[model samples]
Target: MSLLKEKILQVASDLFQTRGINSTGVDTIVAVAGTTKMTLYKHFHSKEGLIIEVLNEHYRHFHAWLSERLDRKKPAERLQKLFDFIEEWVSSPDFHGMAFLKASAEFPDASSPIHELSNTHSQQFRRYLAELAADAGIADAEGLALQLSLLIEGAMQAEQIKRGSGAIVYAKKAANILIKSSLR
Candidate 1:
């Protein structure tokens, strides 16, 4: 990303995450980015366009972070690392539910670019989960991975609603149980 685009993404991601996609205006992003209106419009056709890009950036960064931590780990550790990662994310000061979830909820229709990008990121997560589960030798790995993915998503939402990270404990426990059962 260019310096300007990076700045714009940072400012817009913060604003959109904190304020919301529909509530946040392009001017707010441009002003925060310290750039001109033309520059903003030049890069993104409109606020919706920018919002989609911001969501994509979030997914890209998130996947990068996960890959960095997970790609080098042994199979068992990688599975646990997945749990740990979500736990930490839920407890982070910046926790604001799942960004993709929130964005898709704001615009349920799949036609919106933001909604589409959110779905794409979500599918990527599932694919990663499947790979991890298979690598761990879990029985019916693909199906089990989907279940685990849904469980993690649920845990995140529960933690967000409860305003604490404790809900992740259940997810961890559930994953352990699933692994054991699959082995049997």
Candidate 2:
């Protein structure tokens, strides 16, 4: 990405996460990004295109982080690391729920690129969980992975809703138990 494009994505991500996707106009993003409408449109075809790029950037960062943490570890340990990652996210200073979750909630239709990206991210998470479960030799890796994914995703929302008081604590405990039991 060019410097200008990177700057725009960063500004757009911050604005979309804070003010929301629908409400944050392109002009606001360009202004905050220290650019002009011509530059913005030159880099991204439209506001919707910009939104897609923002989501893609976020997902790329998050996926890289998760992959780095869980790479080539024992299945159980990798699973634990995933939980730890979630805890870190919960404790992040700007943890206003998940950006994708918030975006999907704001735009429920599957026709949009935002919704498609959200579903793609969800699929990636499921695949990661399934791989870990299989490496652990779980009887039904697919099923277990789905359950574990749901638990982690649910706990994230729960933490955000409850303001992260004890949500991570409960989620970690529940996740560990689920992983252990699934391996048995």
Instruction: Report the error of model 2 at residue 65, Å.
Output: 0.7
**Cα RMSD (Å) between model 1 and the true structure?**
1.6
lDDT of 2: 0.81
lDDT of 1: 0.83
For each predicted model, how many residue pairs clash, with residues at least 3 apart or on different chains? 0, 0
Per residue, candidate 1 scores C-alpha lDDT tens digits across 1-184 of 6899889988989987778778988888888889988998888898788887888788787778777888889986677678888787678888777789889889999897777878888898999998888888777878888889888889877876778758898889998888778767
Lowest-lDDT window of 10 residues in candidate 2? 72-81
Candidate 2 lDDT tens digits, 77-128: 7766777887886788877677677777877999977887888888887887
lDDT of each: 0.83, 0.81
TM-score of each: 0.92, 0.92
> What residue pairs are clashing in model 1?
none
Model 2 C-alpha RMSD to native? 1.6
For candidate 2, list the clashing residue pairs, or say none: none
How big is the positional error of residue 6 in model 1, measured in Å on the Cα after superposition? 0.8
**Weakest 10 consecutive residues of candidate 1 by summed lDDT:** 156-165
